[model samples]
Target: MKIQLASSEADIERCYPIVARWREIEKRSQFVRQIQEQQKFGYYFVYLEDDRIEAIAGFHIIQTLARGRVLYLDDWIGETSEYTSGYSRILFDWLMDYAREHSCQSLRLNSSVRNIQAHQFYFKNKMKIEAFQFSISV
Candidate 1:
């Protein structure tokens, strides 16, 4: 019922498996290091209720010429058992409020083309599919 920054090892540990499952990360230590390094550019937060973590969200606030200030979410992984409705909405609402408070003009994220569940949630929250991203690995 509360969202808190996942900074300490203990905090990260609680949500590691959920994130690992979604991202296919193989090592806990590697995830820790990645999160640490990413903190310079973004933040990871955990949703908790009764001392149990139910979701993890990774995001960054950036200034863009196209969108002005935007809240870009890199990940929003929730426990499968609670991912369908209430819990996901709680975190989503919190992020929306966070974006507004930070003076962001938009909240955006890119989900894999295969993640139907996430797309459903996004659409339900009134987000639109505005563009297709093109990229190639170097």
Candidate 2:
């Protein structure tokens, strides 16, 4: 399995549905624009198994006074199939290496409280819960 940047329309078409399983986007045209917007702040990557996409994630590297250099993952969703476990491990291990190589002090991400599968994965992977994520619509 390989993790590659998803930058083309075809790539987005293949991966967006998987992400949509977790976050609702009202329309495909809207999703395309959002992908462009996201590229300004983060990156979208897809995990591939024999030329087919199996997982997708968005992540950004930023410097903050509180955390120094950190890797912030915005989205991570895998095909809810039998191969999910292997795909997840490949993606996460890659991210771990990326964070370390970039000199990031931490890898942080926010998951909806109801996402039990992700929460459990975080726990098993030894990530600590430091604070709640709060947000409001503009």
Candidate 3:
């Protein structure tokens, strides 16, 4: 098992299918292009076993008046059925380790209010609900 940042185009492209499964990306090209643009401040991390990608995490470091320097996770998905298994733990642990290594004050991610399962997982991981995020679609 290995976790790595998808820095090369080939590695990033290899993550497209898994990402598309959980995201509404319309095309692989669009995914690549958008990833490229975001790479200026963010990163895509892939979890691999036997060279097959099993999970992906997209994150960026940010400084906020409330949180200070935070490792903000933007996207996360793993094999649909197996996401609740240890594989997710490995990936999540990796992300946490990374945050500590970078001297981040916290690691955070937002799950939709309707995603009870994800919320449960976050709770299981010992993450607290710090605030309510209110948004209106424009």
Largest lDDT belongs to which candidate? 3
After superposition, candidate 2 runs with Cα above 4 Å error: 81-84
Of candidate 2, the 10-residue stretch with the lowest lDDT total is 42-51
Model 3: CA > 4 A from native: none
RMSD for each model, in Å, please?
Answer: 1.6, 2.2, 1.6
lDDT of 1 by residue, 1-138 (tens): 578888787777667777888787899888887887888666656555445667878888999898899989988877765558478888888898999999999999997899887788889889999889889999
lDDT of 2 at 55: 81
Clashes of each: 0, 0, 0
lDDT at position 118, candidate 3: 79
TM-score of each: 0.90, 0.85, 0.91
TM-score for candidate 3, please give it: 0.91
Instruction: Give a tens-digit lDDT track for model 2, residues 18-111.
Output: 6677678877777777887888766656445546667877888999998899989987878775234677777888888889998999999997
lDDT against the true structure, per candidate, is: 0.80, 0.77, 0.83
Clashing pairs in model 3? none
Better-scoring candidate (lDDT), 1 or 2: 1
Superposed Cα deviation of residue 76, candidate 2 (Å)? 0.5
